[model samples]
Target chain A: MVDVRYETAFTLYPYARSADQDADSPARHPVVIVGGGPVGMGMALELGLKDVPCVVLDDHDGVGVGSRAICFAKRTLEICDRMGAADPMVDLGVVWNVGRVFRDERQIYDFNLLPEEGHKRPAFINLQQPYFEKFLVERIRAAQAEGAPIEIRGKNRVLSTESYDDHVALEIDTPEGPYKIEADYLVACDGARSAVRSMLGHDFTGRVFEDNFLICDVKMTADFPTERWFWFDPPFNRGQSVLLHKQPDDIWRIDFQLGWDIDRKAVVQPEYYMPKVQAMLGEGVEFEPEWVSVYTFQCMSMDEYRHGRVFFAGDSAHQVSPFGARGCNGGIQDVDNLGWKLAAVIKGEAGERLLDTYQEERKHGADENILNSSRTTDFMTPKTEIAKLFRESVLDLVEHTDAMRPLVNSGRLSLPCVYDGSSLNGADDAILPQRTRVGATLADAPTDQGWLIDRIGGRFQLFTVNTDFKPEGLNLDLVDVIVAPDDLITERYLGAAEQAVYLIRPDQVIAARWVNPTAADVTAALNTAMGG
Target chain B: MEKLFTANIDDADGFYAELLAAHEGLSEAESYALNARLVLLLSNVVGDRAVLTRAFELAKQAG
Candidate 1:
């Protein structure tokens, strides 16, 4: 039986020149996103929620073909919630945090990602990329129905792109014919093979992993626990690493490392893969295949995500090996970091120079992802004899000793990027708990009315935990003042001090914190955060 | 319960290459001593006498 949920046909928004533009003139927009994937749709939603209108162009009408990007980290889900798509995604996806690693026949160790309570979202969720794209589109549509000026044009492709000092222009290919569109800023959210990046002649540089992996999604009924399982050299698939993860609809994603010597074409055939599957599941277990593909991963990205008026996001901007679910999760964060800054600049709230922080922060994030993914790739597929010795030694040691367990790198997994040295962050005058610190994403704590995140939704916020200090004279419109009286909030934000105030960015990153703050201090921090 | 043996090395070719390289210029007698020294170092790290005995017995049984 075919799973209809896997096939998503996105509704196409009609393409036409606006009423203000004639046949000889091009339609100009504040922002133009050149991909309809998760990143592009998310960027549009972020801008739309902030009252910015943008056009999203895509060559396809639906979500991705296969069950791609199945792991969504908590940070990504929180960002989606901010962009108005998290509930549907979390409700439909399998929420899981446990992962197990094995060598040959014995399971070495397991991990529980989020052992603490009182958080809004889970550690991670397993949902296919298609569902992710579908939910994001629904969010954009719902906002559009409520008069959010966001438009998505499917079956529209960007044939070429040109950048100018003030704006960027694009040549589009549509079913109706060729048209031109100009934008104050153009974002490339297209997938790995971004036509926009290609036309701009930008170099996406990094290392290419030599090994190929076979990815197969199969619909099966089994009692396997909902945890990530990775094996170094499984008995069934000897001399190759295998990863097994459970997705929604009883579909399981299995990846087998096919070394460079194998016939790439033959490995994908069901005839060749069936025996391996049988060996893995044991003889009589029944299952049906859903999707299959062979892929070689490359950890590469553009040196600079921002080039003049054009910007790149998602796989178009960076690609990591599928081992860690960093590829799409990282893309979500890219849009999250760019969204508020772009919105602020467009609304004349922040200077154009504020846009430069997007590069400073997200490029740091991309480099971190690339570093982690590359190290994981190297450990997984040792290229040298010395590398193999150390890998086996570590694996063998892990089977016996708990000390070596942490060294085992089965995709380090994804975490939020910390902008410790970002120019936008303000100094911490008071010492809080390690969990809540400047340059880190705001730690979620439970409150009486709702979670702290729920109250501090998508705005510049000043949170005062349990302190009744009121601002005497200041521009209160610049920051939303939250007096959190809950004990949990006090412990998280105010450890030893009786009162503390935090200046948070619109993206919920803690910009600054103070023990006893004056209006001048808060105002200075707000200005610095806004690139004043 | 005794710890069961599992297949640890995914790529035997890489493992064998390393194994060969470890004995590159050593004499046969010196290589045998190397094995013994490696076992002693591993045993110290393994720490459990019963577990080490069990592993040795299993290695011999496999042979």
Candidate 2:
């Protein structure tokens, strides 16, 4: 029996002949993205929004089957909102902000991820990966209709790539035949089993866990709340862990941690794993399985994300255990950091040295994700008896006292990265709010025009709050916002200061902030931000 | 910002006796678990990461 729901939801960018196929020489593009996954499409969308020409090539015509990468963090949603692709996702996704941890049959503690009340999106949304890719492709189509120079070629796979001083040449295989194309910058978002990474002979260096986890997406009409439920040493799966999450439809994602020495092939069979699910869900619940797969993850990344004219993003650059929901979130941030700089350099606005900041900032983000995921993996599947002892002790202490609750490590959850001490950062006022300091991503606040995040990005901006101080002759937009006396915009961006000014990057990261500054200060900060 | 090796405990021998008594009647595994919990609690009490890092180095060198 076949389930039609798990099939390709949208046949976006089907195989079509291009002028490059018939040309005697390879057609060159500003950027060529080698994967139609979320990260690849996201990179294209980011460039397309900046009026940069980009081409996306993928082997498949549509989204892959299965409910993979279900958790999209708030930072990812903010990025998508900037790209005009987040509306449908937020509408179709199961929004969740609370997570509950369990031990045996008892609920240890619960946490609200977004305790503050100012942000536009929830802390996280549980939408299947297929829906994520479909939304991105839909946004691309909309951009194309509006005259964005973005092209996607489906059933087109890059067979090999060669790097030169100025461009990268790729041999791509399509259903029709093989064709060649050249790109000034080639981005490889080809996922963990990346052929491009293999072609370059670069390897990810880190630890690989021996334990396997089985994910079962079951469709059942039940009353499970849209909150993440995680268990440690549950009765049904003793000495192991379990995770239950609610998706958009009636589909529920349940992950069972099979021990180290289990047959990977046999465990995914419905005959073997269904009994475990039935035991967990109790008997007499009518349910059908939607998708099932076994996976083992590694917490690893390459030493550098950029290689000459070729760059790696997402799982191709780094792979982490799915404990913290950092996989796609980190990848989205990678392209967000790269897209603007690449566009600026290609447009002759900034020096090529600006692109090196992508490697610097995103490698730090990747390492942070890897470190958190590795800690969670070690806690969940302890390698030594002493490690297990400590884990059990933490779990035991959580049941009785609130002091040890913070020690629980189901997953740290994902947060936006602050590029502290980066070369790109400009002057930062010490008295301003620390959360909105220079090198930090701008926090969303309410303004006269809808959300503050929606009004910024796509270009550098001088964002001012509470005062109408504008500097003339600068090559950037000035967004002067006057809010109520006690609004979150004032509290978040200004702390005890009568006026605040921020020099925001194209990616919405704060380059510099000042309580009071001269026009010369603004010009110097803007020049420093542009790699002057 | 004080160093961790400073003499802080007034009665070191009395505190050592209390620590040994906390693990009196238990198996080897239980003793290890108790020691682990005690280390965690004491580390929380001394919450400075720099101090804990220095303490870790001192303990590791002693072992």
Candidate 3:
């Protein structure tokens, strides 16, 4: 039997005093978030902002060293801005709008992602994950300083947990000792080998790439342009791919494609990767390797994001290949998603039913990310021999075809993600359907990147032109309407813009759109999104 | 379709028009400023009583 009194796990925040309640009912938190990585940390910040107490548990001594997830999408940066880390982050990382692809030393193609800065932030900024974590940890600490009940406990490992009717009893192995803690909700932001997810019997089933890659951070010497550059068939290595990106602190994170045949046990040294670098830099370049790790990309998806009160965010919920910057950014999106919803639920402003929408929205996003990352990875390194040849041919013709330019260059990298179907999505086929052209578009706004409900539309948008029917005299507070002034919206969207007004959610996803937009429809959408 | 949307303040026709401006081209600074104007406009449209009522409901619900 496990001991109940000893609390050994990492406890950054204070636990409820024995004086407050009975021995077992100590005041720790209503929510316990597992894993102390970016997603976990983001959730803690969100909870802290909401005045919801949370405890983050991690077994690692600290954030992982070395460069990983060098690309940060605009959405992730926006969330970091929300947490007050973006300003500093912008200072630390290089904002890249252009990317150049290579086939050996020859520059095959290049592309730009700053599609006129359509939305809030740039398409991406390249930064080291370690430094990014440092900034994130700082914000988390600040939140704690503000008397937000969020704590970070390192070396506090989670062994297992048991969930009953109202709470989950956790059995964590703290550095000090083992402890039994109970929480109203437990979210696992743990990585792919999530013990929490495994304990709940959720399976992460998907494809794993056979091609191995050596990820190395090195100093650059050659006069390569300062854009994210990739080489499909670098002459230095026959039938291998190379991705070179500029990272913060003047380091370059390079990915060298190594076929699966390489020994996994082989140690990573400057020699193993230097040849690739030397191959590209024929002469007059001196660079030293900083850190090197050989990793294989995998695209795996969780069966579900929520199982009862236990929610999984980030890699715990899903794993996307590193391509398209989906791995970390997608997880951050999950944090943004669950953060506000959790506050709404815990505060009782939103119905418990809103909890169900998390799976619907995040799962759809994770799946799309997996698809995008997988597709991009496929283009980068084709497994089949014929596919490899076809990819090579495509790269050869990148000089031609505006249509083929983005195809081979793969705008898939920093392109924003679209949610095809979401409960939070109103009458549109998906949330932010205007931004997503896979199906229909929003009514009023006409922008290529799509319309944000909160920006152009009024706050608490009503989304109706009829203004005629207040029928039941529904309160219009925080509400606005959307009326297509003329053919502008319809033409750009290219059809599928038919509908009355659609009440967009705060996050810009259409909460609901009505064909006729009766008072009942408006009230129903508000009720569904807000739990009226 | 009878659409219900606030005209982006950046638009030449603040709240009405046959043409929709290419709002994407505007800088982030410009867009957020316009958003603030639209929020206050919406607040006015919501009216004082509705605002108080909805705020009270949200507060009560949160409590």
TM-score, one value per model: 0.87, 0.89, 0.75
lDDT by residue (tens digit), candidate 3, A257-360: 88888976573865566777766656557888877888887888888898888999999888987877888888988887788788778878788778888888
lDDT winner among the candidates?
2
lDDT of 2 at A77: 95
RMSD of each: 6.2, 7.4, 17.5
Task: Write candidate 2's Cα lDDT for A402-469 as tens digits.
Answer: 54555566777699789998888999998999999999999998888888888888789999987778
When just chain B is superposed on the true chain B, each candidate scores a TM-score of: 0.73, 0.83, 0.42
Docking category of candidate 3: incorrect
Number of clashes in model 1?
1
- Candidates ranked by TM-score: 2, 1, 3
- Tell me, by DockQ, which candidate is best: 1
Clashes of 2: 0
Per-residue error for A271 in candidate 1, Å, reads 1.1
lDDT for residue A205 in candidate 3, whole number 0-100: 91
Which residue pairs in candidate 1 have backbone atoms (N, alpha carbon, C) closer than 3 angstroms, thus clashing? Answer: A239-B10
Decreasing lDDT order of the candidates: 2, 1, 3
What is residue B51's positional error in candidate 3, in angstroms?
65
